[model samples]
Target: MEQHYITVPISRDNPQDVFTVNTKYRVIRRVGSGAYGTVCSAFDQQHQRFCAIKKMHRVFEKELVTKRCIREMKLLQLFSNHPRIIQLFDMDIVYGLDEVYLIFGCMDASLHDVIHSQQPLDTVHAQWFIYQTLSGLKYIHSANVVHRDLKPANILVNKDCDIRICDFGMARAFSQTNSMPYLTEYVTTRWYRAPEIMINSHNYSKAIDIWSAGCVFGEILGRKVLFQGRDHVDQLYKILGVLGLPNDISFWDPSEAVSAHIKNLCTTDGLPPPTEPVDFNAFFPSATPEAIELLKRLLHLDPAKRITAEEALKHPFVQPFSDSVEESLVPPYVDPQQYYIFEDVHNNSALKSMAIQEIEFFKHRMSQQELSESLLTNNTDGTITTAKRSHTAAVATTMRHFDSSSSWQL
Candidate 1:
């Protein structure tokens, strides 16, 4: 796969130069669609492999949709080589048609599919999957990226149980230099969503991902979603019911009006008060002590106090899978000089133009590949392009992270 980066737009003569999707990739079948766009599997004749092609409908039609597509494209490019993160192969934009196609390395099924199949997972299987999930997230958070949506459905896994975090359309960069983006009132699916996000916390952090991971951790062990809330309000109540409101005074920020809002809603709804707080051991009786301890840290009510991805990787629960003590320790989070702003992708014409520029850059890179030669030869414009592919450094090695039992047959 090419790893080239193109920042400037290239000149094109005829539309055929960039409109080679139909000729380059043979559509296998429609895979799925969501609120964002439609996706399908396609055979890449040049690469001789199956790839998932995400067709983002009406990319340029609305500012919100446009920003979403561009953000996903850029984030994929940034995290392309991470072993546990989905890989981006190529991307194309049909200039005149306003169509955007994002090509990604294909995988068999999602964790959601495995869990929903009602297939039971043993402790080893659950532990390994959780380790890899944290490994991927550790890399992401270390780079100052936040995957707002970390649910079973977004976690793709193959028959071997190797997992890749996918769907970065909702991800954004947040670090010391880059101010954290505003937290959406309610992001991620209700069952997997964090309490802070559900209650519309003004200031949230990477802990959101840890909380969601805890929910997944419990789901895998229990073979059911940990918190099956019907809506945002219920979701908060659900979290409170199990974990109970954090007795730690620092848990709730007084200035954030969401705290009061939650209180009023509970009072207005006339829901009964939470019962005795359920300890982690009772919550996940099958899990070992180390596993339960990690869950407790991850599911903390205070974002400031929650276990970080880096910290979680070194927890005793994951130590059995740790390859090397040094390797398992994820680097501390370092703030980048600047982050790609989602809003800018929509409001700034200069930034929006980067989408086409990246497309052209990718086309120029593909034109140089021996396998891509014939694909571009069909160009009627009688122009040639060439560029060397870029290579991103691989993620540092850690634990084996999986075994034969890792594969989910179901």
Candidate 2:
């Protein structure tokens, strides 16, 4: 296939960080990279705005990688209307190529960059950042989805103190039953992982995100990582050192195997005996009392005891910015199953086909949405004619095809 854009090297120093994007997007520079893919900042001539273009390298190399690629795209589409979640503007895929390109609205910086930079962060900044994080999590949880990975690096922020959570590769939607299915244990960076996950607990919940949010909150106040563990064992040890060992394992309801693993580690790994936890007041001396209180609640060792995203919003620390009206929930009309369409398919070719279908679906949806908006604008301006009215009816018919049953299939 004849490609629309030329391949350009990201920089003279890093020759490997090259990007092949559409001609409409003028590649400016590389923004970030990871095991999954590389992201580059580009100016979209057509849209008159900047966008973050991500290229998933060798997407079909492994089944899991392909599934994650498709899953993230679908999840982003499902949450497209959300203000706190990163929006997926467009995507592209060449029939014979191994790479998939995704375009998202560009942000100024990531929370990680802000935390590591020399810029000063006051109590108000911390309050608003945490509030936005929890607000996004609340909506995600309402749909029975778990982010599984929540850290500073995955959060995008701007100079205005606004934030948008990104990277849904590790996200999963649980069934409506009381008990959650066993999930992959390898998730979230070691330092931000919840205690239950680190201990290999049988079933975890959205509280894992709460724990991570707390770690991020603490990092903001102290201007450094709160746990700073070197390895998995050290990570658990650091957490226990600060929170102290749970008085009883049953408090969080760990499985027998997990309980045994914890006991064996404590007895054989030379871990120090449980000691008094650090004093939050002295630890964050400059922080307000309400902030410290909220931090403690968020970092609770027991998942059951952890503060929920909804309750955290109402905490005295963030209550000033909390608006019940703006904290929106996923519409009841959306079916959670649509997000899991590729879950059962293990074939790479089928996964790739579905991924292409997803891109087409979003492209069609975006065009239809644009048409609807244009029609509405013309109608409001009193420029609508008989032919335009018939066009409007045709657009409405197309929009109706976006219901749950419209999901792409093999």
Candidate 3:
């Protein structure tokens, strides 16, 4: 290791620390701990802002996993200037070794975490997630980087609800030519993998992402992973039961896939779509008809006929629903030091225990005004009032706190 890569002057309050970067990047605290390495909240000394620092374990000189991480890093570096994909900031390499540290956007919660939580995200939240997923996927495809490991866990929703795709440990770049060889990867989290991938198609396209997006959309609608298959074949059946099988023998060759019968039973001489429209209303009771129809189109069995990310963005469902997306996707307006359910004075108090006449009451009678405004406004406007957004976010946040920290006491 180089003795003097670089250093910034700071008080040496602790001298026994193993990490001696002493750069502008001050580790705020560890936010996430994983097998690969720990992700910590950090302050970007150079940029003077908060960031997430990912320090991946540098296993060997040429380990496959390390290479995979590098490949993802390359993609991030290539697309670092974009808005949709998670931004990769300055890289930190251990002075004398091959190890690297990454600083990126620090976020609030992962989509997977929320999906598993008892308090399911409502329609407004779901739609916003889907919209951002499409937008971010569009950005990745534009750069020819197909996010192979797409799932709720890798998608982060920041404090203000900005969606950022993270954990590119399995992401591969696809160019004009195919980079993801079909039989090569059965790598994604099974519930969100594509059918072609399930059957081991070696030369797939960006359509793999389309399939995964369909899964994500369903998860949003159903408030759980739509097809939680314990294995590969089970996942295929879950999808087939919903979308039916593709009839076209031309696209799906039995020679290529494990089950030729899957194609034969679903298709005739030509490619056939699903026998019935997916029961979208069953999954999303409150979703607009347009949104349901859009989901149907996106979940098509034939990848060729699937809706492209850009096309999905242009769909009637998305355009009409964009106002809600903009509102939710924008950085959340939660005050940095704001209370959720419990105020500053009631820091250690229980939400339910607090009386209606708590210490800090919002002035101007915002609740009565909000209720009256809600009644007068038409449903078409569809904007969740600031008061409402604040209330819901607060409720969700506090519920999470209570669920995890119920044992806490003053």
Best by lDDT: 2
Ordering by TM-score:
2, 1, 3
Please, what are the lDDT tens digits per residue for candidate 2 over residues 129-227? Answer: 888899999988888888888999999976556789999998888877735552543688988998777665555788899999999999999989999
> lDDT ranking from best to worst?
2, 1, 3
User: What are the TM-scores, per candidate, against the unseen true structure?
Assistant: 0.78, 0.87, 0.67
- Superposition-based RMSD of candidate 2 using all C-alpha atoms, in angstroms: 10.0
For every candidate in turn, the CA RMSD to the true structure comes to: 9.3, 10.0, 17.1
The regions of model 1 sitting more than 4 angstroms off are 1-20, 182-186, 248-250, 255-271, 324-342, 345-352, 365-410
Candidate 3 per-residue lDDT, tens place, 203-258, comes to 46778888788888887777778877767766776777677654453454456454
TM-score of 3: 0.67
| Preferred candidate (TM-score higher): 1 or 2 | 2
Compare candidates 1 and 3 on TM-score and give the better one: 1
Instruction: Tell me how many residue pairs clash in candidate 1.
Output: 2
